[model samples]
Target: MQFHLSFPISPLVPGIQHNQQLMLMGSCFAEEVGAQLTDHRFNTIINPNGILFNPLSITRALTSYLDGKLYTESDLFQHQDIWHSWQHHSRFSGLSKEAVLQQINQSQTTAIKAVEKLDWLIITLGSAHAYTLKENSQIVGNCHKVPASNFDKRLLTVEEIVTSLDNVMHRLFFRNRKVNILYTVSPVRYVRDGVVENNLSKAILLQAVHHLVNKFNRLYYFPAYELVIDDLRDYRFYKEDLVHPNEQAIQYVWEHVTKYCISPDSQELIKEIAEIRKAAAHKPFNPESEKHILFLKRYEDKVRKLMILYPQIDFQPLLLSFIR
Candidate 1:
């Protein structure tokens, strides 16, 4: 008996290969999937500016990268002895203004090079609700624990979201015409905004994504939002907070991503990589046991073989770990 609805996602044509460069931006879901792709030895960069929830903030970050914009003291504000950028996440905040600018610019520098040759750009939009600073009406990517009284919050309209992202898409294509964009609405619910408001925000993002995807030939949509919400409709798939997906649910989504986005040959390679990774992580009952030593030698041989087969991947870490 079928216990859950399984919606088959359409495969992306010319599936992603191991050698191609990819970037994942927007919400925490991007981080989750990007980490998995990196583990499998795919060349990927995730959230160069940090986790951004709203589309406008995401677009602003991407625009900065395309321009290779450098942040200075004027762009930062000191709060409680720490410096923060309205355009960056709290991760970039630090006690020293110079140190903060250095961190932010370093990421920007890396992103400038990555985006130029990027093959796939995966975006996971989390919400349409945005917060803007009242002092300058500038959208803040991360509030950095700033008092709520200092900012005004509002739900972004569909037209506004579409227009902002449309401009970003154009800028991205101009930078790299070969870059293909894959859009997904994050399944993580923003319950703090109220359940209904979260749904409304997601609706706006979904509409905007489709609008842009339909307008552009290189754009595609992955039904991650539908897969989690409608297909696996259960509280069990969620963490205790009932907001983020549990590890099991994340794996389920990862499986779907592999099946739909990755090439068949690469999928087979991923399984081999997974086996090698599992063996590398194994901790036996007896460290000096001959059986364990044999296990390590076997995986060491596998890693060497894989390295020879895919010279692009760096298996040095796994190779060193297998060393006695």
Candidate 2:
């Protein structure tokens, strides 16, 4: 007599939940999403290393992250001003350029340390095209004062992106085995780049990221592109420039991401944090305690640093006047 044996199917494993610490990088759009996560009380780090404006910058930052040499500056001038000048054509001469370069080098150590402890990494691909410097063949963040004759425009291919991402992933995994990756194609459009080339570039990135996610089990793709294009489906969701998504669009994207990735426990935690914030907002201020005085002093110090870094910023004068 032949006997048939019955076998039971294995239970489905639950999807990965998001109580883990998150680090975000890539384009400016990633910053928007990161801000929302922080506001919601998620353990999200925005550009903990620093903002990366091009592929070469990304490579350098990743190298620093692996080598444990990212930069950290209490002064905003050391961090933002130099980069802003380079982007805005405010730095035209050799002296100014050298200063910016030096600042970038100094920050490498702090950037590395910030990324070392991250459990999740989210990268947003903004553009496949970049401008490379003529002398050193390095990619520049923006085409500011660098003469038009001193640069070459190059559009990166799908293969190049995949290779770069693979290298980044390898480095992160080497440093820490448990790091997982999430990639999103930025929904922001390149309004200045001709329509055809712009669309073509975005399409290439979308396809490349999709392929990469499929190839690696630990790497995942969130459909920010679909949410903007298919779900929102309205031009009004964009900013005045018709390039970046408006606040409403960003809010929707953030909500969708947290709903899918965040754990139930984490959501509960966020709710508790929100209640605390609300209660704090309603409470009257008391200045008698030592702890309260110390907290106030620390906040004052932060404001002082901001004033020095951004002298022309309107709030600096306002804050100074208030303190005085």
Candidate 3:
């Protein structure tokens, strides 16, 4: 006698709702997606590790990149105002430049904590290769500094990637019973790496991540790399560097993501968001109302729209107090 067995295939859902909190991490590409979601009023918590500079700093850096002045350390440091604000924040009490540099030598504890609250984890693996610091033997996200002689780009094996992911997932599951994981490989070519080895490194990462996605039941892989290479292979979709995806490419990626990950209620919220965004885009700022009155009106308009869509979601009264 022969027996037939059946397995359940999970239904693919659309993009998450506006009310769902999202936590984004991994590479710089994830930062771009996080910023877009934030602009659409999604509750996006970026870079849980807090080692990287905050969102405002990222915006300033992107502007510098656009202006063709982001090629040097001096240019990057020109956006110090964003970091200065963090210094005054109570959470950063003991955080100094030296301390942060030292902390980078240790495993990322803050990133581990941030992943704990995430309903959906969006990780974009930039490279399988990483530079390890001499002092603490910890993996550095980017090798922007540290004498070239002291560092070597060590490419992680599939096992290493799986182990690292399992470690993070273990912590997350211990904190919360269930969590969904999404992985993507960044499509940006490492042009500055100055070696064929760079492309090989990305290929290895792509292969390894794909393997993990297939093996894991809960993890999902998004075709970000394919979308760039296959769907938007045209050079026009890229920035001046001919590497990073331009705004158009990013929009295309987001639309594809929305099709698979978003829910019905979230889709409705996004439609409302589009209307709000259009209204805000067309409205002129009235400067003469005794303390930036037009800003208040805009805030009120946004609040009204949010209330109309999510009347049950209670917003803090203090949230409105800041508008005036």
Candidate 4:
């Protein structure tokens, strides 16, 4: 009784344990998956340059770290009483240029360090559509609410997308030869670009990812786009805006990721940690009841024993919570 087709994911590398470091880039979906990885206490960092979608923008951010480029006053433009860089997400903008540079530079320092030790680099491509600011003819990561007339919007060709990913792969392989790469196309619809354009953009991204995966032996695709659009093809799977995957859809895709990508040992520990997480978040009606206190003590013991087994997992917060 197969109601839906499932994507065949590649075998996860043998050494990908909970303690292994991972670097996540591209799209909000990357952030979504990274959040769960972080929740389970996987050593992971998400979109150090923020949620960039287009391939060129993501590569630019990665390469910037390699080149040791930090945003300066010259790189920022004063707009609406704030300083913003076209290379960064709007969240990084600040009232003062120095403040923005401080945040951006700090994050780059962290990302550069993370990149040096990454065991896995997960990339979730969102779209092939890119916007180059007409003023400088540069591929800007975000427009920061500037008028559309100020930017030239264009769809990236398959070759163009491949070149960007190729650059990323070359840099990563040069720096960290042991890092395995996982590529996924985000299922989030770009309805703002029109439905036809959205599909065309995804087609390009799909082709580009396929080309890169074929070119590099350590690279693989997870079929996250197929998971939502094909496996759970229902309007109910979408959020109210009909653009993003709802909780159920996200969970389904994450479950597939766990089954296919995460190691069995880490998966088992994640289940145990989920229970401990559940108990940690639980709040009793009686704030100081003996029953609640005893429950907290049991959770504390459970955490200490598990921490002894897997020292990588963070049991500090739960310990402090129970203590408080």
Candidate 5:
């Protein structure tokens, strides 16, 4: 007997293959999926501007690259003896202004390079709520721990989100005509916003995605939000913070994403790569035992065979691990 309801998913006629390039942005959930794709040897660029939650910020990041925007010392501010940008995640913060701008410019350049060959672009919208800097009236991608009084908090209307998405799509296609776009609403709960507000925020994002999906022929929506709310409707699926989905819930959502979004041949290849990774990561109890050596030989053989079958799959890093 079926225990829980599953979200209805229509498979993309032919989903992403291993050889294609993927770019994912918006929210930490996008990072999680991108990490999985990377682990399986898919070429993917994830969150070049770091984890941007809202559509406006994500669009800003995309436009920054396409428009060739560069960061300068003026774009950064001293925060707790370090330099940081409101447009970037705190991970880019550094002790020197030159370092911060260097990193930010490097990331923007990397994104522009990646966009040229981008095959599938997946964007995850986490929230519709945004913070606008009071001084310049600019919506900051991140607040950078600035005082609350310096910013005006607001939730973007469905129209605004749709417009941001439309501009992003238009710019993306203008640069790359062959790219397929996918969008998803992150399942991470925004408890800090209060329950009702959080629901409203998510609803706005969902509505915007639906509108965009219907408008664009190549755009697709993945029901990651619905899977968490309807399928894994239990507190056990969340972390101690009761906000982010735990490993179990993420795995559940990932299975659905794989089934609906990955090509059949690539699915089998992912399985093989998973086995290779497991073998590579195995720790031997007897470091010099003959049996262990035999296992290593078999492991190397597996890697060799897999590489011969899929020449694009690189095993050099793992192979070099045994050299010294």
Candidate 6:
């Protein structure tokens, strides 16, 4: 007898390679996958303008990168003595405007370069709901703890979402014709928007993504939302807030990603890297012991050997961690 519904995922053609430049954009779910790819030594950039939820905000951020837009004082606004960009996540907020602008501009520089050479672009849309400041009628990526009364909330239509994303794809393909896009609907639930409303929001995102994926040969969709909401279908997989996926749930999706999205030839390399990572994370019972010293030396030698074997990978961080 079967316990849960587990479906097969067809492997993506021309799957992700370790040497290729990849970018994971969109919600917090992107952050989770990006972190895993980073740990496995994949050359990847995650969320340049931070984690954007709706398609409009994501479109805005991507276009900014394509334009190499620079953030200035006029682009920023202060609330509670902290400066923030309506187009950026709270992570980019700073006490001083100069500090905030410096970080934002630096991210834009890196993001534009990343976009130009991007081999794979992974986008995870979180929701269709968007907030626009009532005063200026401008859509915001984040509220930055602003009063809800100051903004008007609306759920984006499927056509609107598709049009927004279509514009992004047109510009992106023009700059990097070789780029392949993978779309995923984030599984994180926004209960603040009401349960029925959240479902409706996700449905809109899914419809828009599939519509675009069908229209573009290089576009693909991953059933991340279905994997969590339908396959797992358990409360235990959720965090305390019942909104985010817990560690186990994230690992489950990541396992599927490795099996379907990444190149099979790189599996052995991933396993070897995981082992080295685990060894690096080990905490010794006796830090001064000869056995611990030998343990460190062994991993250091392993790192050096691996580095020689895969010259494209940067193992300096792991090597340094093993060194001392």
Give the number of the best model, judged by lDDT: 6
CA deviation > 4 Å runs, candidate 6: none
Error of 6 at 171 (Å): 1.3
lDDT of the candidates, in the order given: 0.92, 0.63, 0.58, 0.88, 0.88, 0.93
Per-residue lDDT of candidate 4, residues 79-129 (tens digit): 889888888898889898899999988988888877867889899999999
Query: How many residue pairs collide in each prediction?
Result: 0, 12, 4, 0, 0, 0
Candidate 2 displacement at residue 213 in angstroms: 0.9
Q: Which is better, 3 or 4, measured by TM-score? A: 4
Clashing residue pairs in candidate 4, if any? Answer: none
* Residue 249 accuracy (lDDT) in model 1: 85
Q: Residues 23-121, candidate 5, lDDT per residue (tens digit)?
A: 999999899888888888888888999999989999999888888788888889886898888889988998988988998999889888888688899
TM-scores vs. true structure, each candidate: 0.98, 0.69, 0.69, 0.96, 0.96, 0.98
Cα distance off (Å), candidate 2, residue 41? 2.9
TM-score, predicted candidate 5 vs. hidden true structure: 0.96
Looking at candidate 4, what is the lDDT of residue 218?
91
Candidate 2, poorest ten consecutive residues by summed lDDT = 5-14
Q: Compared with the true structure, what per-residue lDDT tens digits does model 1 show for residues 2-39?
A: 89788668899989999899999999989998999999
Compose the digit string of candidate 6's lDDT tens values, residues 130-203. 99999998999999999999999999999999998999899999999899999999999999999999999999
List candidate 3 stretches off by more than 4 Å: 1-11, 50-114, 134-137, 283-302, 311-324
User: By the TM-score metric, which is better: model 1 or model 2?
Assistant: 1
